[model samples]
Target chain A: MPHDHHDHPHALLPPEPALRVKALETILCDKGLIDPAALEEIIDTYQNKIGPQNGARVVAKAWMDPDFKRALLQDATEVVRDLGYYGRQGEHMVVVENTAEQHNMVVCTLCSCYPWPLLGIPPGWYKSDAYRARAVREPRKVLAEFGVTLPPDTSVRVWDSTAEVRYLVLPMRPEGTEGWTEDQLVALVSRDSMIGTGLALAAASVIEGVEASNQSVEGTAE
Target chain B: MSRVHDMGGRFGDGAVLPEPQDGPVFATEWHARALAVTLACGSLGQWNIDTSRHARERLSPKDYSRFSYYEKWISALADLLVETGVLTLEDLEQAAERAKDQAGGSEEIQKSHPLSSRRLLPEQVAAVLAKGGPADRQEGPVARFQPGQKVRTRRLSDSALVNGGHTRLPNYAAGAVGHIERYHGNHVLPDSAAHGLGEAPEPLYAVRFAASELWAHPEHPGDQVVLDLWQSYLLPEEVA
Candidate 1:
């Protein structure tokens, strides 16, 4: 939405803050108070630079090993503990299993609180006010806007989180992977699958190229 | 013109930012870009006022404009915290210190893991997972009014400073009264910012206003603007 440049009562400031901040930042830069390189290194090592794809590798490993799947479903945090997928906003995680009876969706009515470790930073639309105000009022309509359709009777429960228990949706495994390997199954679990938006990676017979990134923080397994 | 605090003018102005993605690299990080516009505005000394409390809250017009709804809420909060005495300029400075320290040694800071950390425990996780997670905490109605109750929408400003010589919250429904047709459950306290308090997740009510009361056209005159406003925003009206 275009910001109204019109007069707002609170826009009043002492005028000195603007100049003060610039001079302070300049001095900090000159004195090396903040390291530009260090910030880059930190982001590369922790931020959106690494995610879902690494989790995809873990998911692939699990499909090849039943012991791992059991471990994944039971205690996902421990299961993927070694990968170090959890980050600033996603230190704590919850895996929601999608079954025949129910479906799950997530929202942070307060802000776009996402599980960035598994899923990358949320899309811009997720953070928009239209979604926040409308999602609660009419979720089905909102989902449709995202190009997803659900049965008329399917109840969509939108979870509005508050800096706690970030969520990831675990879709039910798809069919036709009878003799698939771990890597093959991992290839099937798309990012959308984890968001509970799309189904678990569809069968290879109809599978398309891996166009989008599917790196989940928790290491999703088909 | 709308009041400085009203947000009605926030409809499709084509100012929304693009999706967050790790591409050829925009400015080093996604958040930096996501908040770049707003942060720049904040640097410009542009800001708004707390309509609920009439406090001076500084926010950039760009951030104020481009921010998603919840981002606005959070921004408004940070603004109010600075304006009111709840959080001082130094408090945020200290909070940043705390955040930095917490970032380095978070293991000691968190007292108990939120429920998600212990999902292996079937019973507790079952409650959240089965119910699709916790319900939003809210406050219930104060009963100062009831359904079929006549009430007036209050006039409020959208910001502390005027940008275009216009306000965000117009007097469209100023002094215009309507009936409390529907009652949604109580919600989080709206006065948290004004009072310089943290949210307690209380209850509030949703009051409905006839469409005619807020706008010019009349589909049903009954078609209304349903507001999940805090009780503090409403006052008891006498029966006519």
Candidate 2:
């Protein structure tokens, strides 16, 4: 019944459920049932209404447009601005490009330094000690668990970002976007692309079929 | 309060010592109040704090696993404030109430406020950067060690150092001898120091390791692992 897609234990400590919990516990701890529901409602509104889906749209656009991609690599803050994702923690950002020679992975070895503007709140796993410790020590091994196996010998540099300078991962543009329109390409991008895992959704022929379903919506509108 | 991975003691030439935990952060009354204050003030994103590449001691490992990263920052910040008497627990509760009120009934909730009434001007961020100079520090001795010159990862086993307990300095490349590949510029002090430990603006170096050197993969023996390491972490071949 939690509003978020996943019930992560290490939810960012403030601004959503944590804040709601603190507020409710203070004002409505005695009225437990009523307080919890309100807290849940607040969390759900943010998660479903205004979180990762917003990030997914940016990922999709970058995949389809070269100019946007260039803008993203050169200056993520400006590029994300074009898409309209600007705010607090996301105020400054640099999208690190993942290349064949070098792979860029993000970790806030200090804390969870995330691209909240582009990716929403970080998941529980990101804040876990396991991810934090292993990320800097054995990046390739940990990545393999996510099904991303880097070629042995590719210099995997793990970046530990802070609030002053945050980072977003720009997964390589997937194959099969060729001949696809910008709108179609956007459909192929997903939140995972921004995290350096799972290829763009369109790379799978199965996703191409879903593309047809999307086309129908456009067809009906026309 | 120590981070688990601050195993700077084992790898480098240093002694190991036992570290103790303090207490459950949220379990007690005074502690909970402090936690609440940190959460509220931190939510606003008013101040900047990060300990990435410094050479300072970190909290005990057990303490680290106990709290989330931001929780750690909040704890560190609050503890520093309380230690310095910047704010009191009573002030925190009052502030939280005020923050909650501002948050409600406001169409646009601003997560940040100026830490001080006198806000920094636009040029301040740039000025800070210019004053801080380059993020990367200058090159050092390893530059003296060429591609073919021999070098070994020095064993720095200082239990107090964050990355020192098991193997501080560079974890993977420790104790391994590799030829110098290139000299990277020096960077601002490593996290260990910045957090409150070692020297500042430490020089860094990059060395190349064969795939077989790091991992014995005959199939990919030709592969190479080029790593950027701080100069203090390395010892010249002549010394070893």
Candidate 3:
């Protein structure tokens, strides 16, 4: 049997893992196996370029344009690529649409395989053991934890992404956003909404969220 | 082999925590470096993404659960570096010693180590990222089952688990009956791909299993779980 490292005294310490990573990176760099600058470039791409905002933009555009939505639903890979959010885990894309009678959720039961190009890095909880196990078994309970309460009559569909093909849930467009521009609609879209764990925030709720965040930032600044 | 990493339906871990409204891409610098090293080394073409994932999954269950997400990445990175002959164990040990020495003193270690056999040019990174790894093979055997066909996942024996070969089929879905939602076209099978057993491209499908059918007592009768399953993992329901 393999030794259990979890029993180590420092396993719970956050700095220890970081230190180990630094040590390995230093060694890899010293051995010329990895380029630190290239690593930074990759990080920048994921952090700045590839993210939920891109997916939000896609969702917002889909909401405004019926043709794009149809194209996205028919062939997401081509549509997403045309929009420049095509790479890595997003080579093969499938957009599941949420309707009045059905809702969709995504989970990678085996590992944390996600559409990185669309939603950026998955949130920490998405990779948790509990979510991976429960999302497929008890999706409604999982969605409830995310504060996404659906009507009892609506059926929930859980997508377990077990292959190279990735999925992005096209959440239903919220009400009271008539004639909204794509840019304005982007504010209502959140990363969780795209993952199907939560629904798109209402137009007014989005404003309230922004104001709340701004107030918190000001409080921190003060 | 069945492992904790293959987490589907088994429970008792803990509650899922909510994510921060707006979290940074990476919480710490090391996390970013870990991602970079994984991607940089991955660009070397030594091993594919599926193989890298198997390396991480092959970690002992205790370590798998204990390590932070990035920690798992670094561990797998080190393993792959040695496995691919990009770096020797001695080279890694020497690097570790150098890191330790730098930590304790002002001694400057020479940054003159020989480069790996393969290196991706900075200019190639964007194109490579944009192109991505499309698993679909141009030519392969015809798909065995079509959409709307009823099928059952093949059951694995205990010996199969003991042998410890990597497989894309999750254990929980094994032997369960589901309807073929759609044929996803020919794609490289990860079970064989992870072990250097050739691409072994085969037909894949979106198999839709009702939540009630998958679990003994499902939370909701209306719930459904769709898994992208490889053809090799399934058989005709009548034959199963």
Candidate 4:
């Protein structure tokens, strides 16, 4: 309420959710159950300190190191925690690698149970009602919406996160980047690929330059 | 039977529309605050993630379908605070009233809160994040299902559904036969843990079901949906 507004945000209507949330914060803070400073720190930690970049690093390392990849596939909790990405929602980790024969995807039918230590807070779509419903029913169609179309012969394996074990998909590394460094390959990884909606960016596709080219593949920049 | 939140294979929700992948993680400040407060309260040790999840599943279908992500979270969080004895309904109403205005009420309310000093300080954030609340328990009952074994999921009784008990079993896979893919050792069972019955750690398995068996018409016939199911929900599928 301290911030004055004449109502012009989100179709000129009141941001009731925002106001109600503020009220809830006030109540919790007044009751001494939560600290205002700690709240800010929590937001900052998720916003800047933790996110997809952590997962990108893990994936890049997995793609580069065979032993590490084996470690990740066999036991992601120990391997991922070794890289310092360990926390709630990702306490028990499982990495499913996408291969030529099988394409892996994940969804939490009951709720959005994502690997937070590596991926941070899930995006809006991951928690959408549409996604929670249809992802399991028709994952191929859902993947198509994300601009990813697998071959007819490829098996679309959809992992519904139902238990404590969280998942991170190790998307197959893009071709034509034979000797790229870990940091360079990190840029090729998008958030969706780890969740199994899209693939890693094409090595020479876009981002640094979005100029029209015949090689502009799906999941390339933007 | 299923609660409103368990929407696995059920269709008709329409197309998936995600915000741009490169966009900001959170849309608004309130959403951020909502998330932060939830984490802070969660760190208080009074409740676990399953308890918070059960709060949402118990919501009426109308509210579950209508409320936005954070709206559902905030509502559930409020009920948790009261249920855990951290605050009362009156306490929430009064604070919400104060939030409506920047007047002198907040200063007085803070002084009156008996547990005020027990707040999670900024310095503790790093340690808390590092040492998260892990659900895995080393010791539990022996494994009942092994990999490659055919198992069928048992449905929840109508009473379990009506009573609003918490369970990890989704409705879509109910009574569906699947092959055990892997054994995930023992972990805290959400069903008993959510209601303060006990952690009741049990053996878990990843059961893989063919799309054909789960859906009347799967878009991709060869596709598979794998679910991590607790042993209690599974029964040995005798060869027929």
Best by DockQ: 3
* Root-mean-square deviation of every model: 13.5, 12.1, 3.8, 5.9
Candidate rank order under DockQ: 3, 4, 2, 1
Chain B TM-scores across candidates: 0.43, 0.50, 0.90, 0.92
Candidate 1 versus the native: TM-score? 0.47
Of the two candidates 1 and 3, the one with more favorable lDDT, higher being better, is 3
Off by over 4 Å in 3: A1-15, A209-222, B104-117, B157-162
Provide the overall lDDT of each model, using Cα atoms, as 2-decimal numbers: 0.45, 0.48, 0.81, 0.83
DockQ, structure candidate 3: 0.50
Off by over 4 Å in 1: A1-28, A46-48, A54-75, A210-222, B1-65, B68-240
lDDT of 4 at A132: 94
TM-score ranking, best first: 4, 3, 2, 1
How high is the lDDT of residue B35 in model 2? 32
Error of 2 at B13 (Å): 27
- Candidate 2, position B106, lDDT: 28
lDDT of 1 by residue, B1-240 (tens): 442223331333333333333332223333442232222222222232113223222345455546444344434534543443333454344334433343433223222322213212223221222222232354543456677777765665232233433221234434556666434344334244224343434333445555456545432322334444444555667775
Worst 10 residues of 3 chain A by lDDT: A5-14
DockQ of each: 0.05, 0.09, 0.50, 0.44
TM-score of each: 0.47, 0.51, 0.91, 0.91
> Which residue window of length 10 is worst by lDDT in model 2 chain B?
B13-22
Docking category for candidate 1?
Answer: incorrect
